[model samples]
Target: MRLDEYVDDIEQDDSVALRKLAEEKSYAVTEYIDDARTRFDETLTDDTLVGSTAPSVFVGRSSYPNVSAGVLAPVGDENDAEAYATTGEWYQQGFSIDDVFERRTGLLNSTRRSNVDVYDVWDGFVGTQREVALADDPVDIELGLDDRPGFDLDGPLEDIAAPRGPRAFAESARVTENPSVPRAIEKTLSDDDWRAEGAITYLYRRGFDVYDINNVLSVGALGEAENRRLVPTRWSITAVDDTVGQYLRGTIRNAPPIDRTLVWHTSYMGNDYWVVAAPGDWEFELLELKAPGSIWNPDPDGQLYMAADNEGYDGRSGYVEETSGAYYAARLGVLEALADRDRQAKVFVVRYATEAYWAPVGVWQIRESVRDAFDGEPAVAETFHDAVRQLVPQLPVSMAALRRKSTMAAGVQADLSAFGAGGDSSRSR
Candidate 1:
């Protein structure tokens, strides 16, 4: 399906707004640290901190079984601490990249060294981390840092989990208040025999968002007791997305195909998405065109870096490499819409990353942006080829380049001369 709704194609320059917002917030980094220092003085007694956690946790993958695990707590305001945790709501609130950074930088990651295997113990720092993960809301905690918290904003942003703030070695941590655990999560945790996949799907069915599920799973809170282990935050995010997406795909496997070729378009942050749902059996492909100067492709004069990954009706046999976590993220978006409608389709997603996408904010943006796309009216086309023709000009890369990268687009046997070239067809990096 092609997007011909020229009226809907017009979008405000969110990039300009984001850049301006970044400039305005750039000077606040030092102020943020200074304010945190003041709060530290007021709260810290004998190197111990009395604060509220955002109910956020992080697990690093730098080492094998050995890793850095932490509890994330806001430095300033304790109220509205729940918002500090990662969620789809951030997208709904229309957060800019700078806004994301501001919120993340405000949190102090109080961490300690621990093994990934945390299935039995439930009283120390790791146990407290699990409690925070399982909670329904932010919890007040008493944290003792070995030394003053470290602040360093100069680094590459995380590609999967959202960017983290400063870090500190935690001497001890204890939850001061009872955290309300949802019955579904409580049940899942109680059943040591319940497999992780079933537990995850159950929580999803009970209305727990993926973000919440990811947090819980990352802390080794799920799975069969003996098999449960702490999962790196980055890997867990993709694992949940892929797992949930597979479950969703199953629900629509036998459903009827969409009656018409439908096209939806939406942009968030600096990424543009054109989702095409053509009438056919279940097949999905995600094609990405990264602008030369975009964050992932830094050379201003470099060719656009194009990447793609697809799955047939039976689903993928192995992990996707080209698009990495984004493949699962984008696929989940399409599968969700399909499952909701009780219909399947041959879906193709075109993600164009403009230079305005100056930083990485994680894969949640992809999942949410594509989910939000279905909320708007879709353009209908008589055939799939027509949709591609209409979308050719709006894309950053030429039809030749897209064809080379996209499996679905490559299947089109149309004459190139009739389609007409638009973008540069140079070799993509």
Candidate 2:
């Protein structure tokens, strides 16, 4: 069967879709695992390089006022490891989740317990921070580990097969050379009064990508006052995505809306996404459909699991409790495309997770997939409901079920009711 025919099968039932998709394309989840395990085994006796192209700083969640600050870099040739750090390259190269894990598993995590707010110039943290935050290119470093670290296959279902990197307490670390620093980063680092948020926005506007900004923030390189502390790596990822997303949103606030409803779809690592942009205010919603046998919903006989979250024109001030990091990541991608067209629209994103998306490759896939989806020819419709009707046959759930979970869809229903009551509507088609 063709791809389109397979997609048509998805709307009927999960088992049918899975069976058809499997028959259409041979998916070797075990092959991916074997490749990652082979690469991970090779790293056991090899010396690794951290921060080759870009350094990764990790802040531990424990110890409260004092947390563990660590730097991570892959174990490989200096040039190769450096290239591995660039996520854009990975995306462009079409690297799979297993490929990403093989590289990440080779990283050496060297850590030390320190006060979160400590940024004294004479301390070791300062040296590591400067090297990671200011370096314009990859910086090679040597680490003295207290002991050899072990690997584990334990993680969330989305990332279960990916081997966790080995970690050890750092006895000492020394940079091989003075890293080439960007003047913009140098200036930002010099200014202690600049808040992290402002620095992130400035760097992003200045053409520095999120990966660079994330390194800076993770190492406690930004923020005002003497209270600047290392942000946990997980937290920093979401923070940078959110910060940049907000910046893009601000630019499109007054921009003209798109001429019509546009729907774009793409899939990566077994997660399928549909991005729908309609003519209206800047409302947004994300609806996720997890197949019964998928990782999040592991019951073979269970119904599909659906979850959604949304926000109005102003966006949400608090965290997106439903989607977590994925919300910000996907939102950033959508906002970026809208900003590029100099247009604003109410966006409704629908995601379908099949059993094939068995392993998590982080939210970067979502961000990039959504970004790329907009590049395709979109399916256009005259109304929001019409667009949903058009898309329903391609999705697993019914329109009524989607409407019940999606605030934006609910809003559409309310709009229809209001129009019926008053006979005319102010919302533009």
Candidate 3:
């Protein structure tokens, strides 16, 4: 019998497939570091510091008018600083959460509390801002700090596992040497009236990735005068995703549909994803399965939890509360792939979070994983429902539950009924 026929047995009793999932989630440590716990040893002292390229910026989320904003650079050789936060390097090397934390924990953040609307050049902070915003390459910087910085490891969902280094309130910062800036970025920054959204879209079209754009925005480097402010790091992440996704959606609004039902599957960092692209309009849905004992569902005796949210052809005006940032990030990846093919489709993405995904790596994993999933050879089916059925075995959740939570699946089922009732239409929305 097919796997679905034994759903009851699989749910109540241990199965081979489930055992395999458990094994995959297990981590293999080659060696243990005794100093791993000593890394957090912070001394409450201040002194002049020099570091390399500006890898990132952090905007603290607290207090309405006054918030802490900082530039992040690793305390290491100038050349290695660029590699510290490079997402491509991290993904290419197959670095785990601990590997990332090991590097990130060494970064020294020079911060200052300023009004959210403080975009004008200041005596001390402006120099740091200019270097971070416009530098084509990492530059040497000297910083004077008030005291030994505190470690910040606090964040939501995915960011909760991110390692943060020591942060000190900045007394002053000065560049040791002038750094080269990209002509395009320099021009955009020169225009004080340019809107942040426009600047982001322009740079993205010019091949600048979201990582670079978020840093710039967080440093208050974009947007028109009177509208510019330091955006919190968490907020900037979603902003960039939303901005890029919107741009892609505009391009595919009138595009043609794909030729057939396509199913693509990929997994990384313990999260498994199956995406179905069916010939239709630009509608999208995300169904998430958090298995019991998974990071998100830590209780071994707890039942599995499934959540989903979707948008229609026109897209949503409000936030996607259920899936949060992953919704926009994954949606952008799908839309970009569809736009590249010059075809639009009703996209359904199903994500399975197993115990293997014990650590949070942020939403970039979702965005990139879904994007890479499209690179593989797809399994084709004649209809949307057929495609879902073909891929259902990969998920631990029951089909009945998935259908209830997946708007796209229900639409496909309804269209099937309409076809049987003598109506010839197969597309929904």
Please, what is the TM-score per model? Answer: 0.93, 0.83, 0.83
Q: At residue 158, what lDDT does model 2 achieve? A: 38
Per-candidate Cα lDDT values, in order, are 0.83, 0.70, 0.70
Off by over 4 Å in 1: 7-9, 19-48, 154-162, 418-420, 427-429
Clashes of each: 1, 8, 3
Q: For residues 232-289, could you state the per-residue lDDT of candidate 3 as single tens digits?
A: 8788888998898888888999998998888777777667788888898999998887
Q: Name the candidate that leads on TM-score.
A: 1
Cα lDDT tens digits for candidate 2, 1-429:
323333454443443544554343224444433554465456544453223333555677787667787777665444675655636667777766556655666566677887767555435744674586568866777776656654554443334543346577777777767778898887787788988888899999999988788878877778875856677767888999999999899999999999888777777767889888889889888888787666677665777777777888998989987888888888999999999999999999988887655556677788888888888767666677766656765667655555667887765543323323311112100
Give model 2's TM-score versus the native structure.
Answer: 0.83
Summing lDDT over every window of 10 consecutive residues in candidate 2, give the lowest-scoring window.
420-429
lDDT of 1 at 385: 76
lDDT of 1: 0.83
